[model samples]
Target: MNCEKIKESVSIRTVLESFNLLPAKENRKTAFYFALDREEKIPSLSVDFVKNKAFDFGTGKSYDVISIVQQINKCSVSDALKYLHKFDLSVLEKESVAEIDYSKNYEIIQVGNVRHPALVQYLKSRKVFEQRHLVKELVYRFNGRKFFGIGFLNDSGGYEIRNKYTKICLGQKDVTWIKNGCNTNNEVIIFEGFFDYLTYRMIEKEENSIPDHLILNSTAMLFKVKDKLKVYHKISLFFDNDHNGRDTKKMIQDDHDNVEDCSLLYIDFKDLNEWFCNFIEKL
Candidate 1:
């Protein structure tokens, strides 16, 4: 959307009214303007148009008229303009701001009051997460780690200390491991994050015996992983049971056969770590 069109859509008057900066006299013929040069005297806060533009003097950030209304009314720009109509029946104002439910991202898995130190340490131990490495590490927590890789690193120990030959970066990205064994049996298991892999490793050590598996870095990335699983003969999905995790389970059940959603196995918290701490005491 063009910024100018964004400005024309919102009412400069309603915004001023909300912040208690409306003109002293109610005269439709009067126009409002702010001096961009004097940042201090600018109503302590006002919807500045053109030269000064709309600004939150508190935050020292400026936005177009539309965005200002969007921030204050807690709605999208388009809806904010439309809802303006209801603000004052006397004026011909008309605008509706879309309602949005804002929520803080609560920690689903808690190691302690402070973030786990190993989570950051494990990321540093991998070359892929190094500053020079192209893979930008996103979220590295006790439950999982996310990696954005340019290309899969070759058989380089610098990237992954374990399974160097598999072209897998264990804690860095989503990984799938498959192997042949006695009885020609095939099985598939999925884990949510890298620490869960380490937790599995902590339990199983060198005896990892699940035949084949996939570690989806985040529940949000499950849609992208489904296409790769189509080639496997049988598949089992182990995803977290949080809102997004349940959404991921639904996405996989659409086509894949022999699919087993494992959230029911551990329903104490969001994912494996929370389950490990509060429920699973064997390890």
Candidate 2:
């Protein structure tokens, strides 16, 4: 997506209107004066409403018109214009055909332990799995375990593999698994991705050591899910310290009120699974 074009053509107001967010702004003046049209409400811009120049979002971040546009529209400055031009309002506006209402009351198709209603709808919308081929493969892979299908992205950007017992969705770059078991006292081990869950399960199978697992799912989701980590007694965050992964770690530290010892063993590779595969390769 061309981020720049979308930014120029789109505004905070536009996004709000498109999504039908609360506290709606009716007019351009209201948008500008109330600053409802702004994406990130920094104290500086929110504080000074009259000047409307040199916008700063309070975190020592300043952006001109172009940058502001990019931030608001979620696109690169260069691609903002083109993104806006090609934006399909009708497609985005239409209620997502892939809505996955996971209420037990709803009529969800259950195969063994896995719920396939939402996942099926999402895949159909994205046009990835025609029927049950992928689902069958996924079921076979996970050994017919039950899983709640949260969301799915059929598009070939990432996350193509799934199984019946696995909730296949368009997840973020990394997932933190907070492992905790009743047998163990209060101890937590954070791992990236579900495969790491399998690895931990394999390594400590005999002891059956359980630690609270916190999977960020992605660097972005980590920022959102950081508050959940505060209550834990001891946390050992195992994350890959790559570009996005480093940001994920930093965001966890900066956003959260508590601090935990986060290890970067996965830094040598992209993620824990890669490290696991390499370990097996040597063996």
Candidate 3:
């Protein structure tokens, strides 16, 4: 199989698990596995299922299925392809489709004003305690499991649920907009996540400088907020200091003449919340 066929037909998780390599940390679509070379306490090898690629965060090296096989078997390129030739492509395709489980049903048990102390501490942990009034506390369940988290309501009535370790959503996917930022404001500060918006509120508590706010929640929904964004005359983005964030910032800036990327303000950090917490810690 060619590289493209191997990537499309073979499941990365199936391949990794077949080798008996355990992941140290795992989320819905991403995981951190111990590097194939050494046994380090910190797992620096990151594998992204969505992207169908793996990166050794410790060594800054990237891996595809071919390289992954080559690494585990200590084989050359031809040998890796030769090894893959034995696998059944039909079964691999079925395994890959089963990897993404989005059929989860989350029932909202309660949604009201924020009062939960754990949720409050969660906001504080992200250094966004002052913006608690703008968010709500939600009690939700999935697969008969009960959980509580800080919720930011999106336009579609879905709540963006966040806690110390969890970041998820219920109902629908969309953006969060706060228009009354000092009434009749013509500008809006955009963020990729709600924590960044709260961090902006914490940093700029001044009465006059508070403009509007927009939290995209997910970078995938960045385009969904484009229509509402055009309503504002000026736009400033505080997207994360990553490739996806930068690309989204550029896409918006290229389309709108009055757009500015404010990421330089927190150039060293990944996002506004990270920068705010680090700054507060230093103080």
Question: lDDT per residue, candidate 2, 6-52, as tens digits?
Answer: 44433433333233332322222332222324455422342221222
Clash numbers, per candidate: 12, 33, 0
What is candidate 1's TM-score against the reference? Answer: 0.36
All predictions: root-mean-square deviation over Cα?
18.3, 19.7, 12.5
lDDT of 3 at 98: 30
lDDT of 1 by residue, 87-199 (tens): 33322111111121111211222112212232232333332222223222222121232211122221221122121111223232334343435313466566765545444
TM value for model 2: 0.38
TM-scores for candidates 1 onward, in order: 0.36, 0.38, 0.61
Query: What order do you get sorting by lDDT, best first?
Result: 3, 1, 2
Q: Is candidate 1 or candidate 2 better by lDDT?
A: 1
lDDT of each: 0.45, 0.43, 0.78
| Residue 219 shift from truth in candidate 2, angstroms | 2.8
Poorest lDDT segment (10 consecutive residues) of candidate 2:
137-146
